[model samples]
Target: MGTSLNIDLTAPGARQLPKRTHVQYAALCFRIREGKVKVLLITSRGRQRWTLPKGWPMAGLSPARAAAREAWEEAGVRGEVLETCVGGFTYTKRTSPHPHMALVYQLEVVSQEKKFPERGERKQRWVSPKRAAELVEHPQLARLLREFHPHLRKH
Candidate 1:
């Protein structure tokens, strides 16, 4: 319980830094098209790796809500955040120089932005989930997309 109390804030080495699991909200952003599930993937700004919309936790917002906000900023789409998330995955956060555990949620996209933030810096595309799985670099995230059912939501 007191492990965190021993962490040194100014530690430069990752080994010296407390082993903490950073959190992020990832939108497994998708849409229904002609009775099929179409997943939206965006190109990462630096390496241009195909990936989902994700961001650090926002103030006063839940994980799913932050996922929605990230969708708007990164993919230029607005969506509905479902209470149920597919699962979580991990990736090394470039900015932080450490791995982050990302909670992935399904978002039903409803609208797109014409001139939103990060425009022209990244490319967004809509493709079949299987195709998206093949395109994305994250293994766990790819598996999640490949296994996600189009009819997941129950009404």
Candidate 2:
């Protein structure tokens, strides 16, 4: 038999490739104010790239509830989440521990916290959906935001 080579994934020095696609909740946090539609975006923890608020499924909450929780944790948003998911988009994976598939939920933010979870690690922004589409790196998410304008209902 030929000599075999092996590397330990659990080793501290070994680099880990992204695992299989993970199903996660994405908060399509948005609001209508002053006759305009605004979407919220938050920066990633380490790389600081702009992204939507999202996380793994919470213990007992429904998907939309979990998405709302993510919004509050990542963006300090408190709001009503529409049960019907507007759309979903595959996460464009980069160098990550786990590649993810995100189900996007629309949230109508009613209040925002001045101090909340992840405040120090992230920065939140409210901008026009068009502007959000321009800033986000994920292609499907960007397109979702771009085409979102027509769905706006006067609030």
Question: Which residue pairs show backbone clashes in model 1?
Answer: none
Kindly give the stretch of ten consecutive residues in candidate 1 with the minimal lDDT sum. Answer: 1-10
The estimated TM-scores of all candidates read 0.82, 0.80
Please write out the lDDT profile of model 2 over residues 46-148, one tens digit for every residue: 7888889998898989988999999998889998886666666676556666667788778889899889878899988999989999999889889888877
Off by over 4 Å in 1: 1-18, 150-155
lDDT against the true structure, each candidate: 0.79, 0.80
lDDT of 1 by residue, 1-155 (tens): 00011224477763442377687888888788898889999998988999998988999988789999989998889867775556767888577776687788788888888788988989999999899999988898888888876434444
Top model by TM-score, which number?
1
Native-to-model Cα distance after best TM-score fit, residue 37 in candidate 2, in Å = 0.2
Give me the overall lDDT of model 2: 0.80
lDDT of 1: 0.79
Going through the candidates in the order shown, the clash numbers are 0, 0
